[model samples]
Target: MANNIFEKSITDSLINRVNQLTPTTPNQWGKMNVAQMLAHCNVTYEMTYENKHPKPNAFVKFMLKLFAKSTVVGSKPYKKNGQTAPQFIVKDAKDFGVEKERLVQYLKKTQELGEKHFHNRESHSFGRLTKEEWSAMFHKHLEHHLRQFGV
Candidate 1:
């Protein structure tokens, strides 16, 4: 089973992994620099908590549910150097400090909100998800990226 992001212990563990990264941390693979990777990771939380990205049209949402939802929220880990969503591609430079702080804050907020807050919540992309699906989506992505930086 995957770690539950809504639990403080798991959240703290993830935070500690984030804290292990520095501005110049080298990636084990992939193109993103440390800061860009952090910013890319922030996109997930931004979709959830903020209206930064436009919601997909009904057809797109349906396709996402059919094809991407399981891969995203399933216990299986993501392969490295996989195709990234357009919105998640961080091409421009980003401030390392700002992006890192934003990610940490988002993780803390998610944990504080607890599992009940996320149960059957309408995800920005995947429509309604159970608490477990939400936790897997949050935890698996962070875990994959943190591992990418060798944290």
Candidate 2:
């Protein structure tokens, strides 16, 4: 796995990748535009640090625990056009700039907090996570979406 995938440098890399994408950038898979992809990437962080969304029900948590957690936190890369949590589905159009800035800010905050802050932290649905698990969740999700947009 890549090192410090949640660090400021990683965030900067993501910012650079995202910046390289124009509004006209085409996707390699799925139906999202670059803006929507950015928005989709933001949802993971949103689920972590914000109270905007409710926690999944017990059954949903069971489903994620039994089925999704391994794939999400494993070393293997996600399959293209993979399934996602429902909260992550972005149906509305997004502004590339707006989502870009928001994602940057979120990344900055996460980096500033450092791995110690997130190590074994309580996740909304997955319960406690090791730093590597957290990193996997963060890095893999972004890479998956970026690949989707052909970045």
Candidate 3:
């Protein structure tokens, strides 16, 4: 089974991995620097908690649900250097300290909200999802990127 992001232990473990990183940490694959990667990861939470990105139109949302939902919320790991969603592409430099703190806070907020808050939650892109789907999506993406930076 996948790690549950709603669990404090798992959330702490993920934060520890984030704490292990430094600004100069090298990626084993992919184009993003450590700070950029951190910012990119934060985009997921931004979509959930903030009104930063525009919600997709009906057709695009439908397509995302049909095609991308499984790959995103499923247990399988992401491929290295895979295509990133447009909203997640971080092109400019980000402050390492700022991005790291934001990521940690987002993780903590998610954990504090707990599984009940996320059960049948409507995702910004993938529409409604169960707690397990939300957990898998959050855990998998963080793990994949942390592994990318060799943390």
Model 1 TM-score, all chains together = 0.98
* lDDT per residue (tens digit) for residues 75-126 in model 3: 8899998987899999998999999999999999999999999999899999
Compared with the true structure, all predictions reach lDDT values of 0.95, 0.84, 0.96
Q: Candidate 2: lDDT of 96?
A: 83
Per-residue lDDT of model 2, residues 59-103, tens digit only? 988888889899998889998877877888998999888898888
Worst 10 residues of 1 by lDDT: 1-10
Model 1 deviation from native, Cα RMSD in Å = 0.7
Candidate 3 Cα misplacement greater than 4 A, ranges:
none
TM-score for each predicted model, relative to the true structure? 0.98, 0.92, 0.99
Better candidate by lDDT, 1 or 3: 3
Best candidate, lDDT-wise? 3
- For candidate 3, the lDDT comes to 0.96
* Reference-based lDDT, residue 115, model 1: 93
Every model's Cα RMSD, please? 0.7, 1.5, 0.6
